[model samples]
Target: MSVLSAAKKVFYLPIMIGEWDMATIVETVAAMRVLVAEARQAGKSIGFVPTMGALHAGHLALMQQAKKNCDIVVVSIFVNPTQFGPNEDFTAYPRTWAEDLAVCRSAGVDAVFHPPARELYPDGWGTWVEVTGVTDKLCGRSRPTHFRGVATVVTKLFNIVQPDQAFFGQKDAQQVIVLRKMVRDLNMVPEIVMVPIVRDEDGLAKSSRNAYLSSEQRQAALVLSQGLAKAREMAAAGEQEPAAIREAVLSHIQSAPQANVDYVELYSFPDLAEIAVLNQDVLLAVAVRFGATRLIDNIILTPSRT
Candidate 1:
């Protein structure tokens, strides 16, 4: 073969190759676009899951759902700073890159867009995307700027990856509600998919911040899930009063000596508006603080039928 033919065989030929065994990790938006564009040109449907770097079973579960739904899955891991409050653990957020990639590989993620903070928010960056009403409840009340940061980064990720569908875990039910509303209101193209929360054997929802908890704190953290469970039971047992449901959840979390209850709210699903009764589908959410680590859990309640 001629030198030109050999170069073509080695370089250009590889570009047209059909598959990626694991995920291709790219650190810049430009690189992600090029990779995704090639996949789009090949007529493959893309699915995306945006995350922070500390990979857990929940993150893998999202990717698994993406794999089942779309032809390609892109997982972006950026520890977005805007989402964290001034006192929150932005610096302390875990960044286990090596283990994260391994999990992506096992879960069949197509590409991993792990951009640096500087690249995502360049010098003199000022724009943000915010969703109102829904933002006023749950985790939003305490972390005022949290959803704004989440909205902005997710919008940027959707614009960059432009997936056919994007996946998020139901563990952050408020986040799911906010993003769905944002996509619908803005008329975004990609479908927002909500996967079920993955919990530990002990029933605590999986989270990166769970790593921050000491043994006692971890034990205390179970109350968040347990409280939501009790609220679920109340709704299932023909209880429709919002006040009663909230009280039941509060009582469960209060039983934990180390647990500090933040909020136990029952609100309308998509709109997140207040409800006097639970006649319709509602979200039961709880946030509790154990030492310095804060955790949140939720369950969606559908009215019981005779």
Candidate 2:
């Protein structure tokens, strides 16, 4: 083979020849884009999962979903500074780089776009992306600027990686809602897909923040899932009032001595508008503080048959 042919072979071998053991890790936007361009040139469909990098089974699930749908899967592991509030755990957020890569490799992820915060933001960066209306409830009421940072960074990732479809867990239900709206409003090219939330055998939704929980807090954290499950039971038993469902969840969670409720809200899905009744699919979301650790979980409530 000629030299050019050999170079091309080396570049495309991972996807073209089905080498599946490792994921190519690129730390800068330029390097990541070069990989994306190579994949596009190879006539491959790309799937992306943007993550904060504490690789749980939840992250693995996203990768598996992507691999099933796209020829090339890229995962970004940036702990975005813009998304964290002043009192938030941004500095203390887990960054298990080697473990994260191993998990991705084990799941057959093709590329990992692990860019530093500086590369994405740069000096004197002033732009931000905000989705109105849907941004005022649930986790939004407390986190304030959280969704704006989420929107901005995710928009940047979508542009940089340019995948055919991007996957997100419904654990961050509102974030998914905000991003889907941004895609529709801005005419973004990639399809936004929401994967069902992944939970533990004990029912606590898997999260990077779970690492902060002490043994007691970890056990106490089960209250979040337990409360959500009770809400499902209520809905299944013909309880359709949003206030009643929210109250049921609140009372159940408050019974746990260590569980401090942030908010237990039921909102109309996708648009996130307040609803007096569950006329359609609605999101039942909860956020709680256990010691210094904060965890959020949600379930999508189906419409009442009664």
Candidate 3:
């Protein structure tokens, strides 16, 4: 009901709390449930941040936001395989458990749940949670089954953590949209809190996939943010046609030698509906592949008319 002040030093570093041996890092759903129950019984509000391993600045920002609002902040570091396509980088995705835990500690997280895939999705796992409709566009078009996996695992995590608030970064805009819809449709209780994307000093959006980029590709990746900025400038200068705005972004990305763009388009905010005119606040989103790594970025366009 109310935000609680964080402890002077909150961490989960494989230490005992007392004779109880209260380990903050857990690997099993049963252990996680115990921690959640203990926190709730202690009258502490829980904040959940679901993420794959290889925590980054964006993730730290999410944890920081959570710390401000909840007395106990928990982060999950499971790389869900169902979210990745057949040829995608499921095997290659970074999984730095020690480094991730360190980051979580630095962010003052109260607990970390690093569940193995087998424990979460044992054999004969069939049921899934999917939020249809607006999912057919944006990142959904390229990786069709992505959101299905996202929704299912998130639903599971929500049930396990039962957090008072869940923290998420806006870099994954469509993901936030899908998960929020899933919560509403299923009548779940955890509040979805969307934080702004934390970017690098060079304007590139912070992402774990950035580790895959070569120096050249890293430099070229700037097209994503640069293009969005140019498009936003055009919208501010009375460019109301969605087609023109999309084209401006597309051209900028295509001109980069190391860049292979997937999509550059505008959609109605929150609903993700396709729009013909920029008559309302819209999301200017782009997905570009630099070498083998795919990166996504977006900016909300709220044009002011005189």
Give the alpha carbon lDDT tens digit for every residue of 1-306 in model 1: 321232233222121223433325676777777776677767889999999979999999999999999987888889999999898899888989778877887897767777778988999999999999789878999989999999999999999999899999999999998999999999999898999999999999999989989998898888887877877788888898999988878988889999888888888886788899889999888888998888988899987774
Question: Which candidate ranks first by lDDT, i.e. highest?
Answer: 3
lDDT string for model 3 (20-113, tens) is 3325777777777777766776888999999998999999999999999999898999999989977999999998976786788788787788
Rank list by lDDT? 3, 2, 1
Clashing pairs in 1: none
Which residue pairs clash within candidate 2?
none
Clashes of each: 0, 0, 0
Report per-prediction Cα RMSD to one decimal. Answer: 4.6, 3.7, 4.3
Q: Report the poorest 10 consecutive residues by lDDT, candidate 2.
A: 1-10
Clashing residue pairs in candidate 3 are none
Error of 1 at 297 (Å): 0.1
Q: Per-prediction TM-score, please? A: 0.92, 0.92, 0.92
Q: What is the lDDT of residue 185 in candidate 3?
A: 89
Ranking under TM-score, best-scoring first? 3, 2, 1
